[model samples]
Target: MLLIIVGTACGAPDTTAAEGTPETLETFTTTADALTVQNCSPLPTSSVLASGDDGAGSVANNTRDDRLDTRWSALGKGVWIDYDLGSVQSLSGAAIAWHQGNTRVNTFTLYVSTDGVNYTQVYTGKSSGTTTAAETYTFATRTARRLRITVYGNTLNDWASIAEARVCGAPATGSSVVWRGDFETGNISQWTSTQMVSADRLQVISSPVRSGKYALKATVRQGDDPINSSGNRNELVKMTREAVGSEYYYRWSTMFASDFPSVKTWQLFTQWHHEGSSGSPPLEFYVYGEEIRLNIGGDPGTLVWKAPLVRGQWQDFILHVKWSPEASVGFVELYHNGQLVLPKRNIATMFPGMLNYLKVGLYRSDTVTQVGVVYHDGWIMARTLADVL
Candidate 1:
């Protein structure tokens, strides 16, 4: 009974077994995860131009520079700071980490605009006078290119000061976010473990980050294997241990090094490996020669999507999957570089009763002699497309 119960719990950690244990009446599966705080990475802004500033160091541009030590301060009640998203985008709110926020409340009004000249008021509120952390203020979703926040001095003084600010994006569809493996925690502590030759195999770097302050730089050399897997790898494992019938939307970004080897073989940067030890992962995103391909099924897998690989530039991907053994019930949808590249396709995503876990980094053929490096960022697993978006 104990062995059966353990095996039935999402296939356990056994991969050599031919079939996974079936779910019993007592077996429980989690379908959804906790909802996020609507704290989407601050929408990217092209340029920040403010109406005024207080001094040389407390300049208008400091608010969006991703730094809290710096601030944008101006004297007066109606002073404002504005931002241009570079292009029109779906906006839902604003997040502000106010200067001296722990001691005072700042009254503010949020506005949005498409042409920068015609602005529409979206929200008017007061900052919570308790913490200096970024506070997200949500409102009706709107499409705009510019965002302005006018502050009416805090309770303590007539100075409008903000340490950092960001425009939050509206969910394009859903909102139930499950987990985030993004390197926002300053390290790889969010992951379950690592499959690397050494500690330098996976480094959390702050520069060249897609969003927030940090990203993972995975480096793989020939014969590098910490888990003794088939291929050489330096991968970060995220043990989601997703169950059958579970659905998730995963959003992430990857950038290949400019000198990444272009050998005529498979080089996987992202994959969802099954519990078993051999064969290909049921679902994987790999670079074959000079092309990026998304494959479903194990050995001799079906190539569902493929594109010419571009190096030195970030590639954004959103993968929506229904975890099921039945081909008719499980499916995969992909959004690449902000466009729907692959529509939902009915297919088996899990192998029999086998469950799946996430692995990110560089995993490739062991025969290749050249070293490979890849940057991964913004790994978010959500129940809704909007949450990942």
Candidate 2:
């Protein structure tokens, strides 16, 4: 009877017979780790074991009993642990126990996952304050294999402890999300605009099409001015999100005024910045047309120009930027409609860090007011600078 009870209380760790006992679970060392994401490296690999009442512990077989770190307060009877779904997996259920001796933890939330790529809260409940801190809760669904337990701030202790993680589920069901847009309605989202300083009359059209593209019209207008000063000169559509420590390649298209005359200097701007928490100057990239040239990292250079402007015509353009440690320059190619036009080299240098925003739109600096009427259409697509080349 004693042996059967003991067996029921402690379940064996999951592992392949050929793999032998793997390493134990280790504490996640960084704050960025608390968020759900995949392919994270530079993490410590040793499992964390509880200190015997002294709050001191050492590394052992982490695979049998793993530990996760939580930013919650380290106060009374609370529980805190993180689950790494290994690769992206479909997670649906979880079971956890709050150390009963510590009375600080009174609430718990169970999170579910799919693709280990993202997680969503699935269950929540209050601790009775009397039950064995070592209690378990079962979930009805069976879709997730990665589970996590988060304790609300405890009154007695700020932290929580986990005795086990029983993940039961299958792998995620599909490919990655191909595309998405969070429309603020009549506003531009997921797009960067490029117009220079002193430029005006930019507007992000919200109605009529309801789900429409941003464009320039003889009389229609859509634009927003950024609160930053560097952008004071040229009006532009900028990407709200940014890349870090890597190069990026994205493409957008525009329609020049059918009436645009040859030799007219106009700029279509999309810029990124490397910023500090307190906010500071950033390395910038500026693209314009006098035959498609660029200003990178504040250094001015010209690639080449093939297609001039045909009145009332639409053209597609590609901007490729590389910023890895090996190479530190940005490259850009301008295409007419679909054909490659002039391609430039070492157009600009990237800053040491990533910029906070990506911008786009049309302007001509001292002459922005006149060219504010150019039409633009297309989506802005981007990936890590390393992925594209």
Candidate 3:
């Protein structure tokens, strides 16, 4: 059964209609319209090089040569190829064509850099193990001059080979910021918290912020009071302003405490809950040990994606969603630490006659006996990808 922790008071009259109502439905658009403007393919002036050349015919240059007959090959694990874009440029995505593309799945990590010496990991995951065709991977837009691909291993062999590699994106045009909650005001006056007891469930802390002097801290301890007939939670809900058919891009940073519990029970950090009822949220971002999961609510429900939940460090997220109940209209695209982990996927984002609202904090099952803490900062919402990227 889905045990949800409601943050509001029990029988709290639906205040959404009394407060600000949701916006009206708007036109539906795809992410391609924004991303295609940047050209996410390999640049003509870009230079390609790699470690451990295979000598026969496969070389680093082969991957960029645009010929399927040519391939870049390296022996053993931990092989990598570097792409120098000739100058710093905005990058939105990358595409790779494996030599034996359909044969075996490959594990790899994509890194970006401006100075070539210092690098940041943007994406890490396994490929679909498809052959012959180029598989495209996308992420939030970032400015960089160098791109690196590190291959750890593959499903079939230790050899790493690529038929082609391409990068796509255009120069950055800053996105418009519609809302922000950096906690620079020294308090969470900009947000509304749902605290059931006098205990400090939510507070503004001074440290561990991505920027500014303050960040929102949520603490959920054993014996903490419950709310709205749900389990103990310390959550902040952004006032309801979303309606069906409206699209939004949200960006935020989150960090799990060092002592964060690893219970098998659900522990929600963030979710887009329907405004109609106190039940499973339409979209949930929760944790299970180091694994972060995204659950889409439905008759049977659906698990869309899961990634490593890196603790101790702040992880950035950019989410683009078009809210709707119809599978053809509603969609979700998730970027983790700038990497496009979940591409635009069609899903039911809302229930019939229901709008959704944003909530962020810590809410876990009663089975969890240990205290839970999570830090949040740099919250923003915008209308376009450029705004949140």
TM-score: which candidate is best? 1
Query: Candidate 2 deviates by what RMSD?
Result: 19.1
Q: Per-residue lDDT tens digits of candidate 2, residues 1-389? A: 00001111011111121213322212212322111111211111122222222234312122113222321223344344455544344434443333442454457777755444476777788655553322445555545434556566444554454432334332224422212222234344443443432333455553222124444332212232333322123344443333222234555455555544343332433444333222211233223334444333322122234343444555555555443111222444444455555454543333332234554443222323433355444444444322221
Residue range 216-241, candidate 1, lDDT tens digits = 99999998867644557888888775
Structural similarity to truth (TM-score) of each candidate:
0.56, 0.41, 0.55
Worst 10 residues of 1 by lDDT: 1-10
> Mind giving the per-residue lDDT tens digits that candidate 3 earns over 1-389?
12244432211112222212322223323222111111333333347878777889788977754355678899878899998877897786677877777888989989999998998999888889865666777777789998888898789888888877777554336654557767788877776545435446778888978877998888888766655444567778775445444567898899998888886656788887765444467788888666778888531257888887777889888988877666776799999988999999998787654556678888766557999999999888876887765
Clash count list over all predictions: 1, 76, 11
Please give the RMSD of candidate 3 to the true structure.
18.8
Q: Compare the candidates by lDDT and give the number of the best one.
A: 1
What is residue 108's positional error in candidate 2, in angstroms?
Answer: 27
Q: Give the candidate order by descending lDDT.
A: 1, 3, 2
